[model samples]
Target: MNYEKRGGGSRSLPARVGRRLWVTAATALVLTAAVYTLSVRTVTGQRWENAVLAGRRQDETLAAARDANHMLDHVTVSSLGAAVAMLMLIGLARRRPALTAVAVGTVGIPLLLAEVLKRYVLSRPELVDAPARLSGNSFPSGHTTIAMSVLFGLALVVPYRLRGIAVGVCALWAISVGAYTVAAGWHRPSDTIGADLLVLAVACALAGLLARTGRVRPATERPSPLSALFLAPLCLVTLGGLGGGSLLLLESVVRLSPADPAVPRLAYAGGHALAAGASAAVTVVLLASLHRIDLDDPAASP
Candidate 1:
């Protein structure tokens, strides 16, 4: 129970948690701002984003669009409500009311923030001559936020032993949702990336709150090595492959004129890769942060 001695450090748990929270929040803010600036505030950024949208040729992305739409269709308000309720039920079943509240905040706060930003705070100027539909403000995709928030909520509420498995499963789904938004043309890659960053910031803030409340504790049980062995490689591969691939594709098209027929197709593929990679990266970071912290405080539980 002596956390101070266990970590081989003089700083308390709250201090450590506070430091992480600040670092994560600052990083998220900077990244979010960068995404908005590059993708919405500049002509080149607009051209690139618009190219991705235009590149969604029916012959190329039809199957992807179909699958993406099918996945996105389940992100209605009712479905999200039910998902939140299910996460709460899991927390209650584990006898962690405080954790349950944190889980709810983790899911709800980001969605609310995304809505406000998209509707009022953020704007997409006519940086380039693009279709009205493509120019509308959708900086942060609501569907992506919902997917990530649900993933974070579930990660918080699940048992420590099963945390790895739960996160692995849910992270895949969340990554898919982000990529799908791009493929379906419902959102730009920036929107999904922004949503991922927003959810990550909120998640870190909520985790710090839990630490301040003394709701976080050291896990009594040892985590399985299988999760580390499996998830580490999976995350690394996904992050490296997709992120690298996206960069390569974008780089290849950078010198090409926008009028080139290949630009749109390459941009669209790059955007899809970027969206999925960003989601996976965020999910991996969240899981790493929660590695040894137990959300349930047994002493505080009934």
Candidate 2:
């Protein structure tokens, strides 16, 4: 059933959309601040040495993982462009004008923001004193931001009934891309985390815009119990990933050895991968909730 109610009910659509926007904005701001603190203050001074060693170890680990590196090598701008073009094509073929809008907004805006922040807004402090020779600003990882934006955009445009699977696949894609960048030494764990938050903020803002403009679809059938069941395991996996990653990070930091940095470095990179996986899982869960709102109305029948 289509709902055109604007202000008649206390649980109106606008109010709910507004609430979501506020929460997203607040979370994004807090995360951005935390990232800045880590980049500028926490990782400098005595901790700089450890951070550099960990990064080099991550690079070494990636060098050993030939298969993983080879797979990630194929994820270039040209290929991603083609994938994005195909996503747009799917939206157009579906004849859903809103899908096209959502796709463009979700992918385009975050990409632009990622570039601007890396270039001008956020600065990568000289925290790593190693001879590893850092090239670009590494506040928010550009590769990660691009990968996640595309994944989230694709999930947003797909059919609601298919969204659960879409989210799962996209989460895996995000995890792989995130891990690849970390292992390649293109980014640190913090960079990946920042990029995730930036993309999420853009998506949330776009969703609020759509909801406010009355572009959201009407109430549909209630969500299936199986849908909820499907997401539970993913959430647990995310929790496991985060826990494992955090433990390794702690071990790496506490057991930092300048002479034999290999073990610590391995732990750091492995932890980063697990952290990335956890971040992906969280993103999937957030998007799934939004999909539920789009497809399932609690007030409606199953």
Best by lDDT: 1
User: Which candidate's TM-score is highest?
Assistant: 1
Report how far residue 101 has shifted in candidate 1, in Å: 0.7
List the candidates' TM-scores in order: 0.92, 0.80
Candidate 1: deviation at residue 99, Å?
Answer: 0.9
lDDT tens string, model 1, 253-298?
A: 5744656777787777788778888888888778777767777566
Clash count of each predicted structure: 0, 0
- Model 2 RMSD in Å is 4.6
Candidate 2 stretches with Cα past 4 Å from truth are 2-11, 44-64, 132-136, 217-219, 222-233, 256-263, 266-270, 288-291, 295-302
What's model 2's overall lDDT? Answer: 0.64
- Give per-residue lDDT, candidate 2, residue 161: 67
Q: Local distance difference test, per candidate?
A: 0.81, 0.64
